[model samples]
Target: MTATTPTPTPTPTSPSAPHHQPLLRPMDLAGLRLPNRVVMAPLTRARAARDGLVPTPMHADYYGRRASAGLIITEATWVSRQAIGFADVPGIYSAEQVTAWRRVTDTVHALGGRIVMQLWHTGAASHPDHLGGRVPAGPSPVNPRTRSFTTTGFQETVTPRAMTPAEIAATVADYRAAAHNARQAGFDGVEIAALGTFLIAQFLNPRLNHRTDAYGGDRTRRRRLLLEIVDAVAEPWDGRCVGVRLGPYLAAGDLFRPDAATLADHDELVTALNDHPVAYLHLRGPDRPTPDARPDTAALARYRHRFHGPLNANNGFDRETANAAIEAGTADAVSFATHFIANPDLVTRFALSRDLATGDPTTYYGGGARGYVDHPVSTWQDNPGQQP
Candidate 1:
């Protein structure tokens, strides 16, 4: 593969334009040069081939359209068959999947975009129907009490069987293999999807993890699994291409919401993670959907102090607020989740103060190009292939 640079369209600004709009400036994330701070957060758009769990042309078109983002983190991809949780979610365990993902990277890079593949293991969040009638694997045998949106409809999360010592080793090996596969697929970097009460998060939280083994017990022990997986990926990438994502206090609809006690553990874990020489740390700040649900300013400040790396902030941030975050030095970059879905030209729209398009929630999850790649771009289609 050839090397490419992410270049944004030059926008002319008036004399009143604020220099503090750090969201529009170019920055270096690890080793990749990002054209802007507007990151496309890893969204789970389940539209891949169900049988092979591979990306399709639709996936390429969807991501290619959003190439204007500084960094495009693809949907959480399964590392192995045991990590399978949802229908139509892509994977990296097979050669065919790798080949298909290379197409996505090729298209994105051809359009001068940087893309990263998020490695994920759903753990107990997976239902048996999606896992070939097999029980899902977890750190311990506890039910998260959540449900998964499968093709068969909403199914209650099952009590996953605790992985044995050998199985734990195998899972770590799976992560290493996935990292290698991602590199072969032409990913700029890899992000570990450790949030949302997945395998790694399940091990971190005491409510879900009830094991008395070495991989359990104390906070350090509970966090050992994640550290081990990170180290596994680090061996190949040398820690430069791996980034870990954590949701300190996220409570989205039907997603894993950490309780008060777990929040304390999350704080300690962030400090512990500082020891690792990984890439940027992505944090999903407080999701304030209602008026009463406000962002925890004090906790966010403490977290910024504790972590000593480039921080990427997420969770319902508009253009103005995201700019404030960068200007205040609270975060290095701001990531947008749903906003990118509606506005493929989100960065351009923000720069020109244009009206953003509203995306169809019905077509957000399982759909074709109707809602994914059909989002209109005003005048930012430089590449012919970027057209939907």
Candidate 2:
């Protein structure tokens, strides 16, 4: 007379392959040992307290549930008040925020999990309302021609004030301070958010950066700000525990179209990172398939050849394909975003070949524990033999 939930049919794996997948292999990430190659990528679920921008017990429980991942990259956290753009996003600039994050880290470590904080600055992606009635700062005074998530709702982005030389240096110092605070918060490392045409990427892309100074104009100059920020962050944690995310292929369709020039600049960016040598190069490509319906394998190969360190490849990778990439030596680790959202036991599901629960898109952001931590673990009743 006990009530029960129906179990979905188990998916089949290759007959010749072992029940254990290549994705389950233990690997090294910037000298830190990982139990598996599966990484939980940073996803922005705005559940933090709005006033102080601090994490709570809910955040601790959310991350603790997914402790089985080899590594967990936390959502983008503002390095300073100037970096905030969206409401309810977390920050690490103050002592209160750092202390709050420590609880989350302590919870994860209690379960023997590794985690890293992703430092972020939204730049032109922010609106004045979110910045205490001050225009956002960026590499150039250009509008991203996009909308941003604000307190009221989605609002159009305004033209951010171009950063002066002094302001640029201040921003780098902010990154340094954030790195120091991250260490205090007990994070395993820090990842710089340099993708999606955000603060750092704004300087990388020519379309967004139209400055006529050392921080812009050409490829080398455009990369100056990002490299400087890297140097600042490395001072606190060293290069071994640092990683940078790059999405050169990402651009505004209506405002800025990508051309051969953009591709060449991205190549230069990879080469520069190779010379500096961070923990890993987080390379992202088109989120979905192209017109040909094929993942950009050529782009992935090109990036792998350029970056000498461990390469963390992201963007819509499934269990089968991700395993294939690892087996083929194309990627050292694979980070899951959406999959991790719905299934806290994503690594187990992949290893056991169990059906994954569907994630609720409606409650993806600005919500409580409904879709954040309420997803049930797979019952796996039909395939009891496939337990990991």
Model 1 alpha-carbon miss at residue 44, Å: 0.8
The ten-residue window of minimal lDDT in model 1 covers 11-20
What lDDT tens digits, residue by residue, belong to model 1 across residues 1-388? Answer: 9999965544443211433368888999979999889999999889998778889999999999999899998899999998987778899999999999999999999999999989999888899998778888788888887888789877988888988999999999999999999999999989998888678888987777888998888887899999889889877777787889988686533335667767777778888877886788888887676744544445566678878888888886787767777877888998898889988888777766666788889998887878888888866444333311
* Candidate 1 wrongly placed segments (more than 4 Å): 1-20, 252-260, 289-297, 379-388
Top of the candidates by TM-score: 2
Model 1 local distance difference test score: 0.83
The alpha-carbon lDDT assigned to residue 4 of candidate 1 equals 91
Count of backbone clashes for each model?
Answer: 0, 0
Q: What is the lDDT of every predicted structure here?
A: 0.83, 0.85
**Cα lDDT for residue 252, model 1?**
33
The total number of steric clashes, by the backbone 3 Å criterion, in model 2 comes to 0
Candidate 2 residues 201-244, lDDT tens each? 78887888999899999999999988888878888886669898
